[model samples]
Target chain A: MAENTAYDRVKAARANNRPTGKDYINALVDNFLELHGDRRFGDDPAIVGGVGWLGGVAVTVIAIEKGRGAKDRLTRNFGAPNPEGYRKALRLMKQAEKFRRPVVCFVDTSGAYCGIEAEERGQGQAIAENLMEMMTLRTPIISVLVGEGGSGGALALAVADEVWMLENSIYSVISPEGCASILWKDSGKAADAAQSLKLTAQDALDMGIIERVLPEKEMGKEGFYSVLRAELCAKIEELEILPLPELTEMRYRRFRALGAQQLAGE
Target chain B: MPFIDFFNFQPKNELEKGGRQSAPIAQDDNEPAKTCPNCHRQIPLSQLWGNDHCCTNCDYHFRMNSRQRVSFMTDSGSFTELYAGLCADDFLRFPGYPKKLETTRNASRETEAVICGTAKIDGRECCLFVMEPYFMMGSMGVAVGEKITRIFEYAAENSLPVVGCTVSGGARMQEGMLSLMQMAKVSGAVKRHSDAGLLYITLITDPTTGGVTASFAMEGDIILAEPGATIGFAGARVIEQTTRKKLPQGFQTSEFLLSHGFVDAIVPRAQQRKTIGSLLKLHSGGAENG
Candidate 1:
């Protein structure tokens, strides 16, 4: 492989694990400790959950994992979490409520893990349980999509107090290839389907599907950590003053508004 | 005893020299006759059932149960049902809803219209779901949505191809908005499954209508429909009444849908299994390499 090829370029860029979001949050906050495992079964590497600091306020963080290479991708299940991963996230979400800490999630995945083992392990029940549990989670939670945010894997995290996605990110129910195959019987028309499906950040914002869009220019891996850290700190500072009841109401209303289409009568 | 004497009935040609006394009964011309729905010929119930749910003369189509459909579409003994026990309760007190439920339950021996399961079609393992019109007129309700959602979720988790044999009158009227909510629920579930890069094919059957037609039924990765199947959203009468015009011939038929890009293929009943199996194999094979 050439040293300066596109793959190498992308690989080098991703090597900086301390993105702006993670770094700034770490430095500005204190006493951050991470948690793992679903307890019902095994732990999921795709979604990492734990108690972390934002300034002086404690918060729960759930992030979608992205492996650095093909081998790592296999290990991370290509960022698609199995049932145990969702279960682990569910466990942490409950803990966040117990300790009265706000939850923040970073979403970046193609979708949930699709494999024989995952189904045999009751994937449907797992996702259903997560949705049911999250619907009733008492703590205020926020989510941000740093990269590709495809379907329920993203929805698992995106259903929060506030949802944000970086510019250039895509959030869709299905990928263009899948849509094209269903509609045209030809996967080559994926580009056209992508245009029609309206899976971009701006399209989502226009449809009132999400709250905000984070600019991608200063959102590189290294820069993303700091920027996210700063944003989280500011958000936490703003949220700390609100009463629990208000936070609870806001969280409830936030999810209730998704996919609300314009009524014909209206 | 002769066949004519078995039913205590006389054969019309019993005395004819060349006519066999025990021959099958010949219809009497100008006599009180039950006209066949397809050919307008007088036929008995025994003949209709003996013809295997088809018009004896004109081959008119007949609605089938999910079990019958799966058998027709998959290899024998291949159906492994998913969410078999998900039944709807009378959550809302709609008038006569309980009676209607009881009637359909007794008639169809099923709790809901749709049955979701994994089956082998022409030797290819596939996750398939079939909707039978006998149960509650195949109306989509909470149970239908839950069952379908479970199917898609299972398909996505297993990296298996998903197939749906869709037939419905519309959303369940008793459930009202709850029924409407199922449109979103199933659509969302199908979307998630599709995003996982799994094959999701939909086979539209006769009388696919209303909210069912608007959502996941139309959102297939590859759509197919049975020949001559009626596939549309608005009822034929309602559309005609609203337009104040005569609709074109063959409107909303599977052939029409194929022409309008709503369906990929118009498959015959006997060939549906082979067609779907080939498509599944091709799609799954492609996925295996990647």
Candidate 2:
């Protein structure tokens, strides 16, 4: 299970058998009450959200669900969420802020849906709203990259106080194939593109884009969820102890300082 | 020439005819003519620039670099550039990225993809950040993000309204997730500025898509776009391939966005200064300016 190259990590990160967002939600939270709809649009199954119990503490849970199997993947749009999914996530996040409950998000998506309908419904606006709203959301929130963290689709859910990524998961601005095609004019060079993208969890950690890399030991097992649930609960409690303004300020600073050190050369 | 380029005579993007333009012309000739992809009329370069870069006959908006945009849109002597020193590093060391950056810097004659600063529109003072289409197609990289963030922070501190004109091909891929995080970073700054009760108007020009669209481009209190400019979350071709269907006519154009209520208005380049100035004045209440 050790991924040697960045491309290997990419493949491992996207392995079909790898745990998806739904798997994490099912394993991490208890008594999950699934919510639905963006109110302005129809509900999207790609995003599954509801209030759930994280170690006896009621928390809002949102995950980008890429269903398993052919039929299920088709139903879940292969985890490529449309605008409604993001809007639904925002609505839930806003509700969490209102109720003063902590929120947890499990992000996994190749990217946002690329169909005409998704574009017509304002996909960019939906994701933009999430980024802005989540920045100032007055409740403790943590996001875990349980699987592939595709560009804006994943970032929509990840503008959190703390972002954790699984050891093998990859976070990137563009898919390796996309980078390959754009840069080299050949999708076959995706492996080279993946290496150049610096998408592995370790690379993200080194760049200070993510806070922690969660161990995949005993992943998908009961022990893994137990440890994650406890860690998440403790982190939420720690964040909850801070004053609202301070918490929001720290969250803002965390992103504000990211990537500020480089580019000094003229 | 490659076989593909031989037949690829039409404009690659709307940057030419469908609405906006970026096709290259023979600049060496004394009387260089820019062929309007929309109207197919050959317009002299000096005359085109004199006409505010819009096609003389069809009024199709042409791509404007950040400097040209600033000069055309801002008051004669009111633009002060900020964050000009900030430039990108191939910290990821992606293959060909450093070389690409060097070549792009030389070609675009820009340190970064966006130029941020303070400017006045019709005597209304505000902060401005115009994306430079000539620089890597105005992609948002780490430095681009940093510049934008600092501009918003500066505007927030100074209590100045922000007028941003976005013309990007989205986040720069070479910078990886660092580029994507700029979306969040800039959004936080934008949110802070908005919370300060200052007006923030976004001017969407040709080819604003991807992370830029999904962040500050759509976060404005009032969003305006150029007519015929392509603006959307996903590219038109990607959507076509994914859906396996022909797109609806005028699918992601400024006019289409206006009809769909995503845009406040489709303002022509000639009318932008006046329109933006009027809005700034209207939004400049005692509470906001105070």
User: For this target, which candidate reaches the highest TM-score against the unseen true structure?
Assistant: 2
Runs off by more than 4 Å, candidate 1: A1-32, A221-224, A240-245, B1-290
TM-score of chain A of each: 0.84, 0.98
**What lDDT score belongs to each candidate, Candidate 1 first?**
0.68, 0.91
RMSD per prediction, one decimal?
18.2, 9.6
lDDT for A137 in candidate 2 is 95
Q: Candidate 2: misplaced stretches above 4 Å?
A: A1-3, B1-30, B286-290
lDDT of 2 by residue, B1-290 (tens): 68888677776566655675455563555698989989999999998999999998999998888899999999998999988988978887778888898999999899999898999998899999999999999999999999999999999999999999999999999888899999999999999999999899999999999999999999999999998999999888878878899999989999888888899998998899999998998888745454
lDDT of 2 by residue, A1-266 (tens): 55489898888888999888888888888899999998987899999999989998999999999999999999999999999999999999999999999999999999999888888889999999999989999999899998899999999999999999999898999999989988889999999999888899988899888899999888899999899999999999999999999999999999998888766744
- Give the per-residue lDDT of model 1 (tens digit) for A1-266: 22333222223223435232333335444676768798978888777667767656678877777665678666776677887888898888898889888888877776666543453354434554455455446777777876666555566666566777766666665555655675577878766666555566666677566778877665445565567678876876776577876775565554334333421111
